[model samples]
Target: MNKLLVLICSGALLSACAGTNIVSLESSVKQLKDLRDHDRDGVIEAREKCDNTVLGASIDNYGCGTRKTLIEPLKVDVKFAHNSYEIPSSAYSQIQRLADFLNKNAELQVLIEGHTSKVGSVELNQRLSKNRAKAVENVLVENFNIATERVSSVGYGFERLADPADTEVAHSTNRRIMAELSHTVSVDDMIWTIYTVDQTQ
Candidate 1:
């Protein structure tokens, strides 16, 4: 009876401690909300805070900081012709812009995602998508001289369609590549990776 009583008391204490943490988190979120909503618009814009800061640097729950290092991710999409992994010369500008951003932010890592329209065989689409991603990756590494280790590529095939219509325009829209920038952010001593757009001008 004595041991059972002791175990029950310990469980209650642990539960109470968890409850305290929940309340603290709620309070902190509220405080951040109040501080960030400066224009009374009830929405916190990225320009209002250190939302453009760098990766691995210390930041608050709302991304405000005493000193921010990294900016947000800059999205640059490169389009492709149907059933082809060969990057068009027209898409070179987008790739160049991405290279410039990567060069400026050395600590930032990039993920180049390849996608295809739903007009080819599944296996063929998969291979083509991977190749498309690789093509972009090569441009950054070989042409721009960005480190290979800093960039990685993935192929999603036609599984994810940007447009579901059965029209040429829609298919053209689906046949493209997506570049996403991400970094790790810490909150309450816990670290998590977050993807945010670069709002800096």
Candidate 2:
């Protein structure tokens, strides 16, 4: 009976070890699978693992998932009065469009940058520019109810002139507010489960 008990205990220990080994093996395979199928396409494409086609190819964090593509960043400019931060009636339509766009795209991040024409004291212009940026931010956050975290403001006083020429058109262009967008989509973000194979059978 003692021998029988010892054999039973040994069998249980061996079973536990086997279970641990299987789990460890599965974890290792998962890690490798993440690297290989970042896009999660069942069939591994040559472009996914490594790039040897183009000389001096820039690969992403993952060894696979490479494609030559061009995309334009989203940007919009809002013109302001010479010394005021108030939103003009003419700008209402543009602002409405921008607000609508932001509402539809919840994942987008925006930066509101304000500028001033070279018309006043540097300190005053800086304050005015900052106010203008804040005004736009307020419109988005208060009226449109956009989350504050998704929007930010900054001022560039009399600097970064859109039109460096000393002309009315140039000054008008210089006194403006710009909204820049930032969006990031990783390979994993675009990933989908193509198919699954049952190996248990």
Q: Which stretches of candidate 1 lie above 4 Å from their native place?
A: 1-71, 182-201
lDDT of 2 by residue, 91-110 (tens): 76777777777786787768
Local accuracy of candidate 1 as per-residue lDDT tens digits, 1-201? 112212223254455433232211122222333346544333365445545544444456556543424435578788898888999999899899888878876888888999999887999999999999999999889999999999999999999999989899999998999997644443332223353233322
lDDT (C-alpha) at residue 75 in model 1? 81
| Model 1, residue 57: C-alpha shift (Å) | 22
Q: Score each candidate by Cα lDDT.
A: 0.74, 0.70
Instruction: Give the Å error, residue 80, model 1.
Output: 0.6
Off by over 4 Å in 2: 1-73, 182-201
Report how far off residue 153 is in candidate 1 (Å).
0.7
Error of 2 at 150 (Å): 1.0
